[model samples]
Target: MKKIVYAGLFTFFVSVISFTARAESTVGYFGFEPDIITNYIGPSSKKMGYVRVTIDLMLTDTSDIAVVEHHTPLLRDALVEILSKEPEEKIKSLTGREEIRAKCAE
Candidate 1:
């Protein structure tokens, strides 16, 4: 029957599309938008400025995104680790700048 044949073809097409759907974090774009800014004043006016963290935050899947339920914590952890490795001056000036790109690229 033509109807049966069409139904089978439709199912096969859907399967192929689902199988070909790619999931990659880099392609998903999970990071900060516009920018992430924070201010810090320390040492009795000896130092005062803002830190900007730029990033993209997106999910490749169609499911609802819940950072707590997903591996998204890895993103924050990586940034923290990188910040820990930065020189004191670097962290003071651009606290999360160097890490913004690195985290999203992961």
Candidate 2:
């Protein structure tokens, strides 16, 4: 009887510890309230194009979500500024799009 109780207690403790660790390591995602929309330079000097993007930030820990929420406005503005400066060709091409994504990640 004592051995069974000890085994059960040990299992419960291990389960609790594992659950806590998993919770702490969980990833969190935060999305912008309104999609970012901005105008970019078109193929020709006389033309102009606009792009709309929805961005979601992935955080390493769920607790960091609040920090991201607090700075959402600034993050949206920065993304808009980055997109607005891009040329139409870069905005449309795959490689260019990847580059833009990398820039945004930075």
Candidate 3:
């Protein structure tokens, strides 16, 4: 009985440690501060509307946080460039939003 109990406890501890390690390796998220705001073209060529978006980047590893922080300016610029060119109609639709998300993911 003592040997059985010891073996079970050892297995549990090993499992717990491996689980913790795997959890640590899971994806990490970094959200842009103050959000991203950009202008999109409205129905009238002379008029433009602004859209505000909160962007979050999913990093393959938590250690990549610093790398993302370093390139935040470039990322923000790319997002703004994408959003600014979209029409107001597309910007407000659900499917269009998903399309924009897909573009961002690329």
The TM-scores, one per candidate, come to: 0.33, 0.75, 0.78
Which residue ranges in model 3 land beyond 4 Å of their true spot?
1-22
lDDT of 3 by residue, 1-106 (tens): 9999999999999999999998778688999998999988899999889999999888888889999999999999999999999888889999999999999889
Task: Please report how far candidate 2 places residue 89 from its true position, in Å.
Answer: 0.6
Please tell me which model should have the higher TM-score, number 1 or number 3.
3
Top lDDT model: 3
Ranking by lDDT: 3, 2, 1
TM-score winner: 3
**lDDT-best of 1 and 3:** 3
lDDT tens per residue, model 1, 1-106: 9999999999999988877763322243454334545554544567565555565555555353565237655655565455444444555545455564454456
Backbone atom clashes (below 3 Å) for every candidate: 9, 0, 0
How well does candidate 3 match the true structure in TM-score terms?
0.78
